[model samples]
Target: MQKRATFRNLWLASAFIAPQLLLVFVFFYWPTAQAAYWAVTLEPAFGGGNQFVGLENFRAVFADANYWASVGASLLFAVGCTAVAVGAALVLALFADRGLRGHRLYRFTFFLPYAVPAAAVGLTFRFIFSPDAGLLAGINHVVPGLWNPALDGNDAFVLVLLGQSWKMIGYNFVFLLAALQNLPRTTIEAAAMDGAGVLRRMWDLQVPLLTPTLFFLLMVNITDSFVDSFALIDVTTHGGPARATMLMVYKIYLDGFESKDYSLAAAQSMVLMALIIGLTVIQFRVVERRVHYR
Candidate 1:
């Protein structure tokens, strides 16, 4: 049986949650409502007045070829970062779970990246990949003009993708490591008793058991790849080299702030929000069926 606590007064209960409610209203709901309104309305870029446009902004967004290109770039960025980050995190978590030498130090060092700011990580990578004095600049010496991300569209996309992936690995590693530690040891022992090697045990036993956590991470990583990469892209590539790295989030910033098109930016932001919501719903409805919750 579950025990329940009753408040002596209804007002007291309301008072307890009032602050949190106020915060949500102020920070989340209010801004969302404003964005939704702005999406459908035309507001002067210089803040003169708002005129109800009724989807004109959205039509304009769809008609722009650059918008479609941005969508394609965002998809590539999302897939690349999610795959690399999740794969690398899983491998590192597996090794860390083995109780090997210096495991504690390794775990600490690996998770440290999560604490660092994304802007700093982007700047660091920008320098590391710079064609002229970067650590990778030696590659240019070996093959003339072959290592310049600033001038090559593919290289720019790759640099942003790698930077985003590296920053996200630590976050995925922490959760995966915790999930691994909590898994049943008897299952692993039984597998070993049956002559299953480490690789076989991990692939056949541990992976199935980890499906729930893996599914959760997949949803989170995909959504984050769409939204959380704005800072990194801004700092590193700024959607340069023919807009190869201009993700949806960065495109919104570029359109609204740089181009001074508030209504268009708001429309794009609403579209992005809808896309994330639709993807999350699909994941829960379709992907959740395969998750083995123990």
Candidate 2:
């Protein structure tokens, strides 16, 4: 009877998970397998006219200067956004860890932006910082032309950074604040009793203990900036006047959708996948050695 019950339970468990398994196989695994296969071959002429040429697509991807430049730009944007967002989140998390008045409300306010749609953020920011008749243009009256991306290359680059960081700050803060809140209060009090000032406690105690959370957030943030922030850049800059903001994903989108070059876009996407996977593996290798999960 017990053996029969165990089998029944296993059947029920599998039944419960079947839908999710189906969805994963249909959407994610199948699409990934197809894309990877497509990456190796030129898209055939409509109605199956072309032959499979393995590795040539990858070779072409490597030989393309524009592809390399777009990838470099994407890396630059990801690194810059990660630095700003993570640093800001750490500071904000520290602040929220203290029992300040209306702290919960403040935390909610900071995290609210993350819940907002990325496409909306991109659209709103684009209008808010337009060359003419934008909110930023109005602010220039008091701030003495503080928003001028039109005339300066450096300023435009900075605007992209600011937009990306603004969108990501809340997302990082949520994870960081959770980590801070979960930390041992007694340990912090003990540190204080031992004459450890705020900075010292943070540097010596909180940070070391929070390494696992920090590493997780860092990986997520970088990966997000790499792939998910395309909407923000697409709406704000459209890769911009001189391709200053031409992230690799944007290039892929342009090639795939805009130019209808499926083969080229597939190649670009494959390269991106390689980059993300390689970096993630390296990060895990290094971080897992030191990450303190407890």
Error of 2 at 276 (Å): 2.9
The alpha-carbon lDDT assigned to residue 1 of candidate 2 equals 22
Please report how far candidate 2 places residue 278 from its true position, in Å: 3.6
1-294, model 2: which lDDT tens digit per residue? Answer: 246444558778999999999999999889877777777777566676445888888788889887788878887888898999898988888878776898989788998878777778877776777666777787677777666666555566667777778888998888888888888899999999999999899888988888777877788788888888788877677787577788888888998899987777888888888888987997787676755532
Model 2 CA deviation exceeding 4 Å by range = 1-14, 44-47, 138-153, 279-293
Q: What is the Cα-based TM-score of model 2?
A: 0.86
lDDT score, candidate 2, position 253: 92
The local lDDT score (0 to 100) that residue 20 gets in candidate 2 is 100
Q: Rate the local accuracy (lDDT) of all candidates.
A: 0.88, 0.80
RMSD of each: 2.5, 3.7
